[model samples]
Target: MKTIKSILGILVAALFVNTAIAGTPSAKKATTLAVDTKESKIHWLAKKVTGQHEGTIAISSGSLITSGAKVTGGSFVIDMKSIVCTDITDAEYNKKFIGHITTGDFFEVEKFPTTTFKITKVAGSNITGDLTLHGVTKSITFPAKITVAGGKTTATASIPVDRTEFNVRYGSKKFFESIGDKAIDDVFTLDVTLVAGK
Candidate 1:
């Protein structure tokens, strides 16, 4: 009877140890982050008297945050100096125009070196967040299609913002003059995509 009681006690201790291990949180379910620079593109279009200048903006650092099952949130930073005007065929013209954009007339990159977006809420592939640009802060929401399969996930969305809200007021005359208007369309659009793996 003594030996049987000892065996039963050992079994109970082993079961308790297993239960404790199972209840403890494990690192296997931690979130992961991934950024794709090559696949991401940021572009802008501004009109002048004759035509519109369109080109891609550079994304310096873009990231996607994810747990084992779903995406939690993410952040992205844009490099203002990377703005390009493809319409300017001459290098000097491009330099002069882009310089003005980075100065007080437009983005004022020196004062606001980076523009960032932090995701605050996510519901059924839709994301809402605070977007800071040109020293102005605003809350914006956009539709992001999220997909998860085989331990990988991707989210894509597009957002439109008014440039004037951020104090960027360049090209208002030249662009709006054609329409005999003083205020140009302030809305600037952005397309964002993020991909991550487990």
Candidate 2:
């Protein structure tokens, strides 16, 4: 009788242990990686009637949340004050052009010194995010080529942004009908490359 009771107790204890283990939830395999600001790049292209201006901007800080070999989420901050005009060879012209775009007429870097983007959803190659520019936030979607390997992630995308959506209407023909040749295209393009790792 004692042997039977001992066997039953052991069986009950094993059953309880199995139940407890089964009830525990599994942890998610997700990790957050810091973006390498110096290694990442953001290139901007703005067009006018006569010609176009292209330049590069600096990213201040950012991070990417990853799961396995995929980019699950991420956010990035752009330093608006770091805008540069590379196409203009003349230093004076480049400085003046940079100054003009950073003024209240355009990006208004004095009031809105930074732009930001936060990922809201990711579906295959498309990434939808909230882009905050010049104090206005709007949802934008762009296709990115993302690769995760060797403890690092690299993502590249060309994002088209409408200047008028963010209240940047200085030389936009969409805002002023009679602006004529002086009008700049409302849509500008930003080519972004982001590199991040643990």
Candidate 3:
């Protein structure tokens, strides 16, 4: 009788342990974010002999990592083929110049179709990362204001990058000639606003 009672008690305890272990919740998966391309915009300006031309760059789909309340640095890849500069005035002339930009001269889009930014650290509203452009990777830190509201996230950041650093030397001389040796500024400011839906 004693042996049977002990065995029964041990089985009950084992069953309870098994049940408790099975009921425990697992770790949540990382939240994936989608870049709102329609709401997002990228533009650049260059001085010409006459005036300045402005254009937009297109962003493709990418992912961002986030925990429950914190944003883990993620990667963003930009599409280089979608560069548009409508201020050229002449349609044919603009098309020819754009084609050249896609080649080795400007972006080298064929060899490197995408420019990637990998976030390495996040400090308050400042983000530090490595930005790869024109086959060269450089460490860059920029002020990024990140906001999370009602399960939706929005981040805005601005960074000034030198065109010469990326080997983008088009219209430098002509633009400088127009502006008295200071035509186009080497540093072009990039304003990025990214929205993500949880």
Q: With candidate 3 superimposed using the best TM-score fit, by how many Å does residue 132's alpha carbon deviate from the native?
A: 0.8
> After TM-score superposition, what is the CA distance of residue 69 in candidate 1 from its true location, in Å?
5.6
Model 3, 109-159: lDDT tens per residue? 988888878889988778888888888888899888778887777777777
When summed lDDT is taken over every stretch of 10 residues in candidate 2, the lowest stretch is 146-155
Enumerate residue pairs that collide in model 2. none
For model 1, residues 110-172, the per-residue Cα lDDT tens digits are 888889888888777678888899989888888888777665677777778778667776656
Q: What ordering of candidates by TM-score runs from best to worst?
A: 2, 1, 3
- For model 2, residues 34-148, the per-residue Cα lDDT tens digits are 9999999999999999999999999999999988778889999999999988899999988888889999789999899999999999999999999999999999999999987
Error of 2 at 158 (Å): 0.4
Q: Choose 2 or 3, whichever is better by TM-score.
A: 2
Global CA lDDT of candidate 3, please?
0.75
Compare candidates 1 and 3 on lDDT and give the better one.
3
